[model samples]
Target: MSFTLEFFATPEIPEVLKECLRVLKKDGRLCVVAMNQKDDPTLMIKLYEWAHRKFPTFVDCRPIFVRKTLEESCFPVLDSVEIFAWGLPIEVVLSKICKENSKRS
Candidate 1:
């Protein structure tokens, strides 16, 4: 479970998620809670992005396409929800690990 973590610290998100998938049991689940504004770009999200670009080290995390990123990393999302955190949009996602999902084309 990663809560307000990787999306900020890890530069290789897909790789990290893929590695997680590789290490988990077939039926294991992965959960992540991070800032996302792909579907809903709010003012606070924009400000965060600006801060991130201007100060990479100070503001490491910008808004991202949470579900899209997870799916692209090869995890099949089971459940996802949007929540508010300090006026910014946050996404909480739960996904299952599957060999099929891990398969590369």
Candidate 2:
């Protein structure tokens, strides 16, 4: 079986990965992408700060924490690498939901 999942903005992928694993057949591969610190350290920090400021109830605003979560969830680590894409500012891609939510809080 084949499936596709998309996440808007930065989401908690650990649980999502587990869910995918549960539903996926053997030999399936999972692909994931998230706004990383290398995207724009300032923007990443701002997004995380705003997330925490708005939703202080949850504690998943850090990327490293997200990675740890994936590991804890027992997802296989075939290959892990950090990517840096220059010339593309992340502030432009920042979601309105995060911005508005943060502002509302």
Candidate 3:
């Protein structure tokens, strides 16, 4: 499980997850808690993006499309829930490991 870490990484999420997928064991699940734009307003998300751009060091994270990113990365989202933090939307996502992709040939 990762807590507020994925969004902090400078690499694009899908790229990072691709590397992670290479290392993850078969049937190993991944859970993430991240600032999410899935259930939030565009303005709110844009404000976060603005903050991230304005103060890259201070605001290391920007809201992401959690489910889509995970799914695109080949991690099928098993469950997702949106929670608010000081009025900002956050997501708790649980994804199943893809057995087919667990090992490299």
Candidate 4:
């Protein structure tokens, strides 16, 4: 399964990851591409922040945060890469459904 997550502003990431795992096949690989928030703020980042201020419910997505949530959901990350896209940093992670958990479900 593959998903491109707009981690730059998503709050329900943990719940989303859990749902993804639920539908994933046994031993299936899941790939996620998320915005990296570690770098200096770009125009997109500034705009996102502005929007967030207007909407307090907005989420500021971060790579480390999402990774932790994914692990908690029983999806162990197998590989990760950082790259630049459209002047924004992006994090790509490949994870797999844990054998034991997949079997249980």
Best by TM-score: 1
Say what the RMSD of model 4 is: 4.6
Model 1 clash pairs are none
Q: Which consecutive 10 residues in model 2 have the weakest lDDT in total?
A: 91-100
Per-residue lDDT of model 1, residues 6-90, tens digit only:
4544467777787887787767788888777666577888888889889988987767677887877777799999988888888
Q: What tens digits encode model 2's per-residue C-alpha lDDT throughout 1-105?
A: 111222323355545655665665454444444433443356646666577678866734333333343445554445545444442122111111112222332
Tens digits of per-residue lDDT, candidate 4, 7-42, equal 423566666777777787877888877765654677
| Superposition TM-score, candidate 3 onto the true structure | 0.77
Model 3 scores worst on lDDT over the 10 consecutive residues at 1-10
Candidate lDDT (C-alpha), each = 0.75, 0.41, 0.75, 0.66
Across residues 1-105, which tens digit of lDDT does each residue of candidate 3 receive?
A: 444555545356677787778777777788888887655466767777798899988978777777877887899989999888767788999997666686645
Better of 2 and 3 by lDDT: 3
Question: Against the correct fold, how does model 1 do in TM-score?
Answer: 0.78
List of clashing residue pairs for candidate 2: none
* Best-matching candidate per lDDT: 3
User: Sorted by TM-score, highest first, which candidate order results?
Assistant: 1, 3, 4, 2
TM-score of 4: 0.64
List the candidates' TM-scores in order.
Answer: 0.78, 0.42, 0.77, 0.64
Model 3 off-target regions past 4 Å? 1-11, 39-43, 102-105
